[model samples]
Each structure stands twice: as C-alpha cells, then as structure tokens.
Target: MIIALTATTQLGGIAWLIGRPFRQSLLVSLASYAVLSISAIWVAPAFGRTPLSCVPEKGGAHAGIIFCVTNRHYVTPELKSALNDIVDDLNTSFPGIQLGVLDASFPFLNDFPMLPHLSHNDGRKADLAFFYKDSDGRPLPGGTLRSPIGYFAYETGRSACPATRFDLHWDLNWLQRVWSKHELDIDRTSKLIEAATANPRIRKVFLEPHLQKRLDVNHPKVRFQGCYAARHDDHIHLQL
Candidate 1:
C-alpha cells in the first residue's frame, strides 16, 4: 500500500510540472498580443501608416484659426533656425502681430496633394501664415484663409455653383516692403542667410522670383548664392 501511494504522488507531481510551462506560455502570449495592439493604435499614426486619432482643432483666442498639421521629426536643425530667425524679425517689425508656422511637413501621405514635390519631402521647407485682424481685437471679415501654397480643384463654368477653382498667391508684398524699409530686419535676415550659406555643408539657396528681383545683382555685401530652382514659389528651399 505504501509503495502504491508513493507512485501516485510521483505521477501527480510530474503532471503538475508539465502544466506549469503551458500556463506560463499562455500568459506570455497574451502579454505580447496586448502590447502589439496598443502600439498599433498609437505609434503607427505618426509614420503616416494609420489614420490620426487627434485631429487638430482651433484653440487660440481666435475661433477660425485652424491648427497646422505637422510632425516633429520632419524639421531639421538648419531649417528650424532659419524659421526662428524669420519669426523674430517679424515680431520685431510688426509687434503683437499673430503669426504662426503652418505645415512644416505633413505626416499624411496625401495631405497636400497639390504640393507633392514640395521641399517638405526632405524636411527643408515650411509654410507660414499670418492671422487676419481688424483695428479692433476681432477677427477679420473674410472667411478663413486658404493654404498659402498648394493646388485646389475648381469648376471652370459659372453654372457649376458647387465647383471651386484653384487660386495660388503668396502675400509677400507687405514683407517685401517691410524688409526694404527696416534696415535692422534686412541685416538680420541677410546675416541669417549668409551664415546658412557660409557653411561648406550647404550647396545652394533657392529664392523666390520676387526676392531675386529685390536682391541687387552686384551688391558687394551680399553673395550670389545660387540660381532659382523653379520649384520655390512660396518659400525658399535651401540645399545642404
């Protein structure tokens, strides 16, 4: 009887040992699956592979001011510095003006279909927009401003009431006038571009046609960095 009891106990212990590994394996598999599910929900959207959960909504003091779509990884150091310098000059020139940076680089694949070949592809371009305001602290009378750069589809015929047309224009006239008159702002932007070009790392500086016209061809102080690359209509694209 004692021998029989010993054999039964040994068999029971063997079965318990065998089951422990299966239980542990099941727990591990569950944990791995949970982790993968959470990652797919959050991390995948940042790379343009999935739809974004957090769509941008209007926040600031203004209601119609829509937030820009951007990913932090798309901005390079050089581009960021250039943008900051521009903002500083703008703030100094037009104090208390509400200026904001728009699309630096859209994370969505088809976000800006019209500007498919934009410099944002390589993280070297940014779209900027200014807030419209009246003499009072209220929003202007017009509808929200469309994107400064990009193609839009519109109907050619007047009968097509629902149809719209593409209109492309950059409001740089004020900026041109301001830069022309403000010596300090001009010097700042010039120096910024100079530093950008001085680096042996940079290969070219693309300027808009209007900007090229404004720059003196034989200005001894300014360097003729590079010829226009045809693609830069709204913002200058610097190549490094």
Candidate 2:
C-alpha cells in the first residue's frame, strides 16, 4: 500500500540520518530537546498559565504580613528577592513592625497628589510607615502618630532642583514626624547606616542635616534603619 511504502521511506531516511554520526546526532538531539524544555518552562507563564499554584499578587499585601508596592506593571524576581531581604532585616531590627505596601491604594500614596519627579514610579522605590497600635490592639491611623523628633530642611536651595521644592506637591509632615519620633541617637544611627552601606545593593543614604542634628543633639531613643537618595525627602523611597 502507498501508506506502507511512505512509512518505510520515512524510517529509512531517519535511520540514515542517525547513522551518519551517531554521537553527534545524539548530542544535537539532546541540545534541541533541552532548548525546547527550557522554552516551555519560561514561556508558559507569558501565555497566562503558571505551574505554581500560588503566584504573588501585584501591589498588595501578601499573607496579611509583608506588603509590596511597585510602579512597574510587573515585578522582577530579583526585585522581589531583594525586597524580601529588606523586610526580613526590618523585622529583625524592629520586632512586630507590621509590614504594608504603600501605593495608589489605601491611605498613603493613593489619591494623594504626588510630586512630579520625586514620585516613586520606576518600581524600584517604596515608602514604609511605622506600624502602631492602640491599647485596644487596633491599628492607629497614621495621622494620629506623633512626628519623629527631628526637623528637616534643605541645606542649600537650588532653583534647578525640582525635588528640593518637593514640599509643593507632597505632604511630608507625617514622614518627618515618624523619623523625628523614631530616629536614634547619632551613634546608633551611624551603626544602622554602616550596615546599610555594607550591603552591595544599597547605593546611598541621605539624611537631612537638621534631622541628623536633632538625632545627634536634641532627642534620644530614635534610630534610623536606612535612607535613600536626596530626592527621597518627600517620601521614604527604597531602591532594590
């Protein structure tokens, strides 16, 4: 039959192809298979299906524990890992500090007019608020919290620097209060700065001179965990 002859020809052609160089053919076949397998592993997710049962939700708290915020549409695995490390470090540094993400969501960044250039839009930045509770064990609203013990002011005003004038768009009173209340003395803040600087991922930490002065001379018991670049004065922005 024609089908039988066709099958014979196909088998014969394959046998000839394989016999030409057995070792090379086997290696080439294996390499092709590996490529296909890897492609399948990485490509399936893009098509809207995932192998894992639990996928991380975007721009929200996970497990009522750690919170996340990103400006980008998707979060890279590297960023997620780095954020996890930071959260772990914070928990170790301050026990029972309830973690939450600030985005275009609830009380923090959501609905608030953000500063133009100072806003955390690159998905690499975040603002963290200290968690506080009342005697009834209920979360105290951020507005109710006392300001940190420090005062913040620009050392030099630059007409060219829009971020230096960030007070025009953002309300940093709450953040200033938090830092003022919680900032540690200079010696302790220095230790925290040292630890953050030692990390390869952290580029820099900028503290307002006035804020630093307050921590150094004015009040005690306040400790700074870390800080970002100068542009982050309007908000506590974290880069990963």
Candidate 3:
C-alpha cells in the first residue's frame, strides 16, 4: 500500500504512516491525505512552488480532478505565470478557453522522481492537453479533453521512432476506441504552440515531429522529445 501510494502521490505514503495506528485506517488515511494535499498549497510556495487550481479557473485548470487528488499539480511560480499568460492569450481570440493542465511535478522535493516523467522532478515542467472539438465540428465547452485525464487519446499520425520494450512509448491501442469522438482542434492547438514558443520564459516544448508539421508549428523551441520518452502527440510538454 505504501509503495503504491508513494508511486501515485508523493505525500500519500507519509499520510498512510500517520494513520496506520488508528482504528479506522481508511477514513483516517483519506482525511490525512486531504489535509496534507491542502496544506501543500500553502507550504509548497515556501519551497518556490505553487499548486495549480483543481477547480476550473478563468484561464486554466487541471485536466481532471485526478491530477489534484494525486498531488501532481505543482509548478514553479514562473511556469504557473507563463501558463496563465498563455491561456489568457488564447482567451483573447478563443474566448472562455480553459487550458487543461495535465501531469506536473509534485510539491516540495527537488530531484524527487515523478514516475514516467523523471525530468519533471523539478517544478519547471508541465504537460498541457491538446484542445479538442466535438465530432460536430464545434469546440468542446471549456476545452474539454477527449480522455478523462487528458491523456492516451492520440490523434492519428506517423512517427519515426522504432518499437522499444523498455521505453514509455505505449500505444494503448485497446483503449483508443473507448474515448470520446472528439477531433483535434487544429487552429487552437497551433495557436497554443505559437504562444508557448513565443513566450521567452518557456525554454522548450516537446512534441512529435509529425504533429509539428500537421499543426504547422515551426518554432525552434518546439522540438521532439525523442523515442526514449513517451509520445507527445497526445499532449504537450513545456519546460523552463
């Protein structure tokens, strides 16, 4: 339980320990985790990190509540500001756009591993979901993602990366049929990349080569993450 909790949420294992000796372990542990997670919003800033809002804000929001519940929505102040700025920019042309923030670093530790994204150990990296339009050719309300957690719903595209047994390049072919029938909103996505690349604070944006061509994203800062890392066609990775 501790291992799984720690793997999912960095602070969950410690919360488990805090509730281990109690009579109602499940309730105690859950309550403990809630307290710890909420406390992180205040405590994390001391360590130079800020927690992204779990609720849908004016400009941005966690792609799903799962990210906040798992304690995976913390980022540096500069990054948070940059994301807000990008979303604010998007709203000017595309009104009421709520940028979906996917996996981000945990609060507190530097060089502490966030599984699947080892480089996200620091608070400088975050994943943003691609904007999607409903099958009817209309933008989904508030930029809703095709997948529940803003991941694994890949757009059809070709890649140069070869098959590897040890890497994180999971196709998850079986799950593709289960997602919502939403088409990638190419205009919004292209604009998002342009805005992100234009931002001087964002040093790099990792995306697949095919997507760059498909979306007409040609900025030097927008580069491929390579075969060793997970595919970025499903989401965008921005780092300082």
Candidate 4:
C-alpha cells in the first residue's frame, strides 16, 4: 500500500520509473512488508493491543507479568467456556489484575488426574493463583511463575522467588505448608478470591481455611484448603 501510494498517488509518473503497475511496485518493496509487519507487532501492544491466548495453541502472551502458567494442560469445551467468561470479566472489571492459570486438564475429553491431582480426572477443575499487591498498595509483580502445583510468590522487581514447594521426602509432602505470611502480598489476594467465586458455574474454591478467616472472606463458595494431599495456599482451586 505504501509503495502504491508512493509510486502513484504521490507521483503518477513515478510508476514508470519503477515498473508500470502497482503490483510490480509492491513486489519490489516486499522487503518493506517484512520490516513493517515485524515493527507493527512489536509496537502494537504499546499503542493498544490486548493480548489473549489459549493453552496448547496460543499461550505465550500475557495480560500482565503478574502470573505464569506452569503447565499447558488441556481443557474441556465446557471448562474452556467458563475460563473465557471469567477471564473476560476479570480483564474488563479489573483491568490490571492479571490472572495466571497454572493447570486444568488434558484434551482427553474425559475425567482423570493430570498428575498430583487426585481429582481433576474430569474437565471441571481449573487452578489459578491469588493476585498479590505490594506493601504500598500496588498491584503485585506480574512475573510470578507457576510451579508443579502452587505458584512462586516473589517480591517485585527483585531476583528473589521466595515461594517454596513440598519436600522431596516421600511422606513429608502431605505435612508441608503452602506459604508463609511474609511471602505473600495479602492485600490483593482477597480480590482474586472474590473474582473466582463471582463466576456462576464455579461450584467450589479451595484455599487455606485460615486465609479465609484472615481475609474475613465470608463467601460460602470458598472451601477448606484440601485434606492431607495438597495445601491450597499458593493457588485457588476453582471447580465447576
């Protein structure tokens, strides 16, 4: 288009200098197309590009650096519908609050544990982390990475990923604690919990009961963190 404009609209006689037709001029400027396309993609976000993605297909782009998805688990059509709706709401309602989905299920089209999860055998389960805020009451850092189960909670703008996981010991896993109070940005976690519960299809939300008490989250949708299996401190288990 640029070439066509430059070769014709700007100077009609200029077409003869390159080659008669606009098509010929376009071919001559093929290299320009590559450069412009690359530049456009790079610059689009700065201008006003809202990035969206689906795991196993388009999962790289993120709304904010706030969260990282640990695994590219497959999702059911129903689960995907719920996920999209929740994300759409969160994106619009809480513009800067980026939700990180750690795991779902596989595309097997049936129920089964996706490893470490006793349940989730079906497509009705999804995992997302609590949104954190800095001490000064700012949105938590976006670069938190998802782990095998829970999420990595780190202080913003630092190389520290202070969050820890279960012990490698065979029996110690069940006795493990999810997170310490100092490691989390508690202010924003409440909002993330409410958002997960906001969805109508959400049947249950699993998190540490003590947290539920600490935040005074009276929502009936929130349930006790789990049994002797995995502690639900680092992440929220949203199930339909």
Clash pairs, candidate 3, are: none
Superposed Cα deviation of residue 10, candidate 3 (Å): 0.8
lDDT score, candidate 2, position 191: 34
Residue pairs in collision within model 4: 65-142, 65-143, 66-142, 111-121, 111-122, 112-121
In order, the Cα lDDT scores of the candidates are: 0.35, 0.33, 0.86, 0.49
**Weakest 10 consecutive residues of candidate 2 by summed lDDT:** 63-72
Looking at candidate 4, the ten consecutive residues that score lowest on lDDT are 59-68
The regions of model 2 sitting more than 4 angstroms off are: 1-75, 104-115, 130-198, 215-234
Global lDDT of model 1 = 0.35
lDDT of 4 by residue, 33-61 (tens): 43443343344344222122432222121
Predicted candidate 1 versus true structure: per-residue lDDT over 1-44, tens digit per residue = 32332122212222333345675854654454345434444553
- Scored against the true structure, residue 81 in model 1 reaches a CA lDDT of 53
The TM-score that candidate 2 achieves is: 0.36
lDDT of 2 by residue, 1-240 (tens): 323321222122233444456667656644543454344435534532222111234322221111111111222344344445554554465443333333211112222222332443333444433334455555443212223211131222222233344244333444443332332223333333343344556543444444445334221222233222233232233444
How does each model score on TM-score? 0.34, 0.36, 0.95, 0.54
Model 1 weakest lDDT span, ten residues long: 151-160
Candidate closest to the true structure, highest TM-score: 3
Global local distance difference test of model 4: 0.49
